[model samples]
Target: MTEATNDTTSPVRPLRDALTFLLIVSATFGLQLLTLVTGIIMARLLGVEGRGVIALVLAVSVFAAQLSFGGCLPPAITKLLAERGANARDGLGHVFRRRGWLLLLPCLVAGGLMLVLLDDGAAGQRFEIAVIAVVVTLQTLFFSIIGGAMQGEGRLVRMAWVALTPQGLFTIALAVVAALDWGWSATDVLLAYIATGVLSVLVAMASLLPAERGDDVGAERRVPEASLWSEARGNYVSGVRPLDGLGLERILVGGLLGTTALGLFATGLAVSNLCRLVSNAVSVVVLPRVAAHQGDPAQQRAVVRRWFTISLVLVGGIVAVLELLVEPVIRLAFGEEFVGAVSVARWLIVADGLLALRRVLIAALQGQGRGGVASWVELALLPVLVVGIALSALRESLDGVGMSLAAVGLLSCLALGRAVFRAPSARHRGRATSCTQQRRW
Candidate 1:
């Protein structure tokens, strides 16, 4: 009698995927919590005005870091790995190993330019800020590249661990130092960040090295040098433009409203953007899958739809809660002096909910190789952001400015949401016809 063939399907549940998602979400949430705690401690230690300065510096660093990286590497690596699978590891390594330095060159130049452009009352503090900016930019770029590569290789669990561990340790260390009555200067925090950044990079590189070793998959198809360069260029260009828009908006706000006001606005925005962590965690998982299924329109659409629905429902629920409890949250997390931030934080929640939904749509576009379109969309919206920020900055009162900015948030959300919904869908008959026509070429 013929023995029944064993079902060789791996018995392991999609626990790996679930764990990967959880790890990133946990890491993001932990980082936010640590920062919140650190911020609280720093406020108590440094008083309101000093805390405001720290927040300002952090805002500048965050804007610089995001603009410097251009949000390209993560999606680029994810797409390449998804399309090429395990056989693409060496090529992926080659891209990262070679272009990594080139990616950093811009950050150094931009950071220096920003520092030079700013009016510095004291040379020592200016120099310190410059150092912090450089360190922060480097830290951001390294973490993004390493994290992206790991996610592309489908080892997101390791990537998430690498991403979180250093930040977690640094946060804990900072809290200890603050509790012990160590001076809470900008230099001290910058040093802590640098130390953590170095540690995280080391861990991520070590974790990814093995996966970067190409497996014996019986001779894979060679990716052309030109094609790889073209892909990288496309990703870089597409990614940088939106980030530029965002950066420009922040810079204008900082310049027009003074650092203190910028500090308040930025803090509120950061807290609100924390909700996007949920969508981001999901995107890391969804990006690779979407890329893998790009050739199959039906499958791609199904995946995108599923993730989008889940994101909207989750983010919407969280925003509702945040809107209700924003006052208590702000007072508890950032101290009573920041009680004025409650309204701004609520507005940000509304904006972030819209942004979260837009992210899912953008991810789908990126996965489908519509980077150019995504880039154009961002460029188009730059004017809207600029106008909103300018009008808000012109206000004399903080509450008035906050309300005007909230109006901006509402407008931006509506515009972004419209763009997302109007984006080309797989189910569109016209798109299907276009796909068929393109296939003939």
Candidate 2:
């Protein structure tokens, strides 16, 4: 399992790390490109109204996913496995039995809510959509458990494959659907996601389970006993898990606007989010390394500084290019009605850039066991987003939604800055001061 970890003090290691990072980026780009292409195809197939219903339904699906995986399982498991290195299966089994099992009830509940929304709120094709939502949520829950195991073992290439399989499968399914002239309703399109979920879980399980039978450098070593899911409690929802809150916001949009409006907004979101997809690829590779190096504060800072610079330069350059092409691209992809999407989209690209940087920052913080800072950051941002997006969508201007999201990104930047840039000793002194005041009182 040994590879180019971040713990090395070798001078030439940076070059190797850079090369490896590029590979990760390249692989990640392929996955995201597949997703973008799938979106474009789906948009063309379904037109605006179909696309909106698909977007809203998928939003609900994403929320079920979040609730099912729980917040802390992936990172917590990954961190624990990275540290122990002795018994991957024991750590993994404990995690699944504890927090992973807990996700089933929430998945069922989210699925039930999705059924209510589809049957009563969405109407038409309700049975099919509801069934897919429940089944897919259950599929994702198991897939996530295996995914956490892959990450925990630092089998990153394997992990990337698990991540990419669903997109690849869905892309292929779309092609077949198009070839067959399947009527591209929202329900018709969602079958691609559901089918892919089942297939990918099988692929991920094949990767995650093999490490149990194999021996590695850390396999025979002994360590102190601990619960697999010990870290699954507090920050699980906020910092530990992917933001379901974002999905809920989209649902809010669907409720406020009709399907067509939601589709337009979703298109703008998807376009702007392309850069975020790339940045997230960088993070997927970076997190385990960060977690491995968390014991040394000096190494942590160095690691943070290096990646922060890389993110700014890389994401900044991509943002610049995307900004220039935003208009022509939107017009070409979805036609004249969405030309206004370009204006809204440019701001969202900026927001995505900021959010991407925050990902790097949060990965570092979570690696260092300061996950509470990230949890607090999310807690603070949610209200700002909910209110801002609510007012803007109600006002019938996507420009408002774009600007509000940008504002949230900016706020996240500042919060991460406080956590990242503040000296540890200074933070300690501040905490000490607060503690003194509390004791005196």
Best of the candidates, TM-score: 2
Give the per-residue lDDT digits (tens) of candidate 1, residues 1-441: 000011213354245446666877987777767666666666566654445545545545555555555466565665555445543346455555556677667556545744653443324576667667766767777777667666666665566566667767777777888779887775676677678778877877777645433355333433444665565666765565452323554466556765556556655765677667887787765655565454466676777778778887888898988787778877777777777767777777776776666566666666665656666666666566666667667763444444544454455445544543444665653554555355331
Q: What is the lDDT, from 0 to 100, of the residue 100 in candidate 2?
A: 51
Q: What's model 1's overall lDDT?
A: 0.61
- The reply for model 1, stretches above 4 Å from the true place, is 1-23, 47-65, 68-70, 81-104, 116-124, 211-226, 241-249, 288-302, 396-441
Clashing pairs in 1: none
Best by lDDT: 2
In candidate 2, residue 62 scores what lDDT? 63
RMSD of 2: 5.6
Clashes of each: 0, 1
User: What tens digits encode model 2's per-residue C-alpha lDDT throughout 320-373?
Assistant: 998998888888876776665677788888888888888878777765556677
Cα deviation at 144, candidate 2, in Å, is 2.8
What are the lDDT scores of the predictions, listed in order? 0.61, 0.68
Kindly report the root-mean-square deviation of model 1 from the true structure over all alpha carbons: 5.9
lDDT measured at residue 419 in model 1 versus the true structure, 0 to 100: 48
